[model samples]
Target: MPLWWHLMKSVPSLQIVLHRIAWSAVIVGAFLFWRDGRGWLKRALSKPNTWWMLALSGVLIGFNWGLYIWAVNAGHVVESSLGYFINPLLNVLLGVVFLRERLGRVQWMSVAIATLGVAWLTFRFGQLPWIALALAASFALYGLIRKLAAVDSIDGLGVEGAYLFLPVVAMLVWSETHGQGGFFDGYGVAMSVMLVVSGALTALPLVGFAYAVRRVPLSIIGLLQYVAPTMQFLIGVFVFHEAFDRDRAVGFAFIWIALAIFAIDGALRARRANARAPLVPAASPR
Candidate 1:
């Protein structure tokens, strides 16, 4: 979806984000109403703590989206890919620390190798990859919040969208009145359509992800998640023709190797577990 930004050269990244938030609210809100009417929303609202957690998650995801859009447009796509590449490792570490989950020997080694990759990138780049780090950290936190929250994924997304909806709409209106709105500034019909569809593109994947996460094994999801960042990296290098000099290549190689080890170990563990016990269907998230 970030590649879609290439067609939106004239649009401000922030404006795109506003559109994403506002329209995602519309889509998810409509779905919730159609599915369960207002009961789910009312139940969510009655609990202040739930909404607060969702609101914070909303802020983190919004930040992640805005930064990612800007980075893709500003020629930092490769670095953006690196952020996602680091995210699973970060998630594992977060789990170990926050949830008291224990990491096996292989997992720890994988984390150590990934850390070395980031260190190498930092050393060779002569500075920290702040964009990458921020994206990873924000998204990791978002995932953590969502995992801890009691609400269903779509409903949680709806709540988050609701939290941002009015403010984002007001901002868009302000931008339009000030003649700074991309949707109304003669950017053409195609740009307007892209902006509108961005919301569906955002919500659908998340909904699908929520559905899949329940049905799929964690190790399989870990492997599948790499598909996205891998495509982004390929697009950056092959399509955008971004630089992939020797030093950057070396750094990425370390990360790739670490991911390989991590994935292999997870898959093996999962296979053994399945063999030892019959597979049980996971309960749907509520």
Candidate 2:
């Protein structure tokens, strides 16, 4: 996805974002209609509170997407990767503060270590890593909103798409009519296809994430989630050749250590809990 975004660097971030939202709505709407018919969507939208929550979450995810597209295209992929690396720890902190959940000593220590990493990055860079921080904060908050909203993942996603679909489509139409659109403004057919496919690329991971969240333990998912940022980090350093000198490496090392601590601690706890209780069936996707 980052690679695709990087390839579309010439396109405005807002333009790409609008295409993403518009096409995702079309794709998800089609899927929903196929899976459960129109009645399902009507039922999902009937809950006024859920609709509002989806609206709020839509804004958050939209902001995250826009910032991420801009960051990747602006050659800040490493910094953006740092954001995801920091996100799990931020999720833990958010849970503690907002969900009133308690963290173990290990969890607190990990959070502290991650904070130190961010602090060091800020100190060395001579400015706050605002890109990383913003991405992490926005995504973490989006997760929180999704967690609190009592709806299926697909339903919530569909709702979010619906909320932004028409306005975004309108914006795209206006942009194209005004000769400022990137979609067909001499970018070639390949670029146009890529732009449309971005929606499916965006929606598939989310749907898979929702499926996994239902069936897999949160601890396991937490561990698996690292694969993405790890790949992004590698792509940034090796593929894009972004600057990652020793100083930045040191900061990333601190966060990596913190993540190791966090992952290990969570794994041990999950192991103990499973040992103490009989296994329950995983939740159905529906």
Candidate 3:
């Protein structure tokens, strides 16, 4: 269903995202409460320290989503893809600067290559890749907030979303209050049903990512992270009928190569980590 909606966005972008998220949130929220019962809600909402964390991440996620939606709608998906392509490198940079972690020479080169790719893209286009930059900045900040929040991924998403969801839903409603929104008018009833589905749609990928985050090696996670964006990039050009000029294609190719270097670095790090230790299972022994 998520893939369906994503593909459907060829006609319209933000509207589809809005509808999908609205639906996904409903189901995801219900599942959270059901699976964890009141425990989940209490954990997410009650901690004062967590509240600030949630709010910050919530706002950042909202910004990220909204911009991505807008970018797709405006036929800027190529740039948007560039943003996500840049994200991993930005993640590494954040680790160094914010977490005070050391970066090896290879990591520095990976960053430099990514930087060159962005500069090349910008120079070829004669403008900054705002869509990509905005996506990278907001998402990088979200990652920082997530790490510092120190809450379980599931609980944190719900909490931060709880903060932002209302205003977003309200605004969507308000935008159409004068009359049914162009997007919302037809099958108003059906769309509403779908909107309730948004919560689940919203939660599932995170759940997939969360599962992947824990179960998969970071090298694998880094590799898998590219899947969704790659799909988006293809859908943009092939499915949505967005243009992919020669220069833009070259830009993306370079980003992909740079990402390959980044992923290799991660794999090497993971390999060394495994070599240095018991390679103990994450699960504790009874």
The lDDT of each candidate is: 0.89, 0.90, 0.74
Distance from true location, Cα of 120 in model 1, Å: 0.5
Over 4 Å off in model 3, which ranges? 1-22, 45-48, 180-193, 279-286
Q: Sort by lDDT, best first.
A: 2, 1, 3
TM-score versus the correct structure, for each prediction: 0.94, 0.94, 0.85
Candidate 1 per-residue lDDT, tens place, 166-198, comes to 999999999988888868655678888889899
Best by lDDT: 2
Residue 32 lDDT, candidate 2, scale 0-100 = 85
Model 3: how far is 284 from its true place, Å?
Answer: 17
Q: Over the stretch 1-286, how does candidate 3's per-residue lDDT look in tens digits? A: 3244554454345555555556555656777888898788787666557788778887788778768866766677667877888998898899988899998888888788778877887999899888899999999999998897788887787776677667667766865775545545554565555555655666788877776788866677778888877877877777778878888777777778888887888888888888998755698789
Model 2 residue 37 distance off true place after TM-score fit, in angstroms: 1.2
Error of 2 at 31 (Å): 0.3
**Any idea what lDDT model 3 has?**
0.74
Off by over 4 Å in 2: 46-48, 278-286
Residue pairs clashing, model 1: 152-286
| lDDT for position 13 in model 1 | 88
